[model samples]
Target: MPEPATEEGNRILSLWQGSWLAALIVGVLVWGLLIWAIVAYRRKEGDGMPEQTRYNVPLEILYTVAPLLMILALFYFTQRDQTILTKVDDSSSHSVNVVGWRWSWAFNYEEEGVYDVGTPGEPPVLWLPVDEKVTFELTSPDVIHSFWIPAFLMKMDVVPGRNNKFAVTPNTEGVFMGKCAELCGVDHSRMLFDVKVVTRAEFDAHIADLKERGQIGKLDSGRSEVAGVS
Candidate 1:
């Protein structure tokens, strides 16, 4: 059966293909040359064995140099792809703080001045502008947990004492589901949230609407209600 491919799996596949093809070529050439050398140098069953020239420095060098160059080329491209794909360009990117509580995710858009404090019915949904970079500063309020959004192809561990930083840019605009990939405790299964990627205008509208609805912050009337009671 053919193996399935994923976006990340594809990147890995390409990296392996480079080294495998080079090795395959060398293997076939080495085998063919060995056959030819064995046939040409072999002595008849009854004939005395010819004296052997044990080692050729040039031949040994050729074998060593070929594989070494292939390996170096493989490492070079692998690292290049890693840096290009994962490096964060913060200057042009927006920043969000993703905090993992006991069993919830709160995606705070620090740049937008909105922080959805993760209520029960309304969890913090990360709204990102498609094709734009966004930096995530991840931390956990208690215990260890993991933050993963598979569709965007990034994940990192959230430690209580440390803040993890990474970046991603969604290529397609859509709602991608993410969950606490770690087993934090009994309620870990319910730690779910969605990442919404929209256009810049739509994102602005969403924050405005969320703010108005008292989802991101206390709505104007709700605030006035509290003031009236106090």
Candidate 2:
């Protein structure tokens, strides 16, 4: 089956294409003008001195200003996107806490509590609800690390002794492979994590069942497996 689309991925691709289009047009026009000038001033092998003149002020200004204008416009567009992307939405959004460890990842949902993620001997997997914006407050238990989901265009540094936050709204529902983008230790490449974005119903069911079994949330820790917290 095919993977779902992501807003971040789509935006990044569009930004790339748009930025190149402007630059490519400018580049082709500049080269075409240069070619026309050279051809218009072509000198026969034995022809008299080719007409030559020092740089014209207007021509010089046009040549320099064209590229400068393009750059300024691109900068403005990029800055606008960065601001829009980082701005927090006022609507209700779920929050998840992800922690970086020596060679694994841990996820803590405020409503569902925490759990040992991944396989018993393998790295942990991150689970999320598709189409939901998640505020991940990241920190490291030991060394510094970086979290990255390439398909989502989300990456952030996980620093020890301090918390760093990044947001993501994953529209796709699939397992996205993530890794520590920063080199923290000898086994940096071994630090891997999996993101599982699922449906809202599926997530709610999991949370409910987990809460009942006391598999999540510390408040229910002392309760019996099949009973509510007393």
User: Model 1's lDDT to the true fold?
Assistant: 0.70
lDDT per residue (tens digit) for residues 26-123 in model 1 = 89998999999999978778888677798999989998998898878878988987776566665546888888876577767776666654533455
lDDT of each: 0.70, 0.71
Q: Would you list the clashing residue pairs of candidate 1?
A: none
Residue 202 miss distance in model 2 (angstroms): 2.3
Q: Model 2, stretches more than 4 Å misplaced?
A: 1-4, 34-43, 48-52, 89-92, 117-121, 141-144, 208-230
TM per candidate comes to: 0.61, 0.75
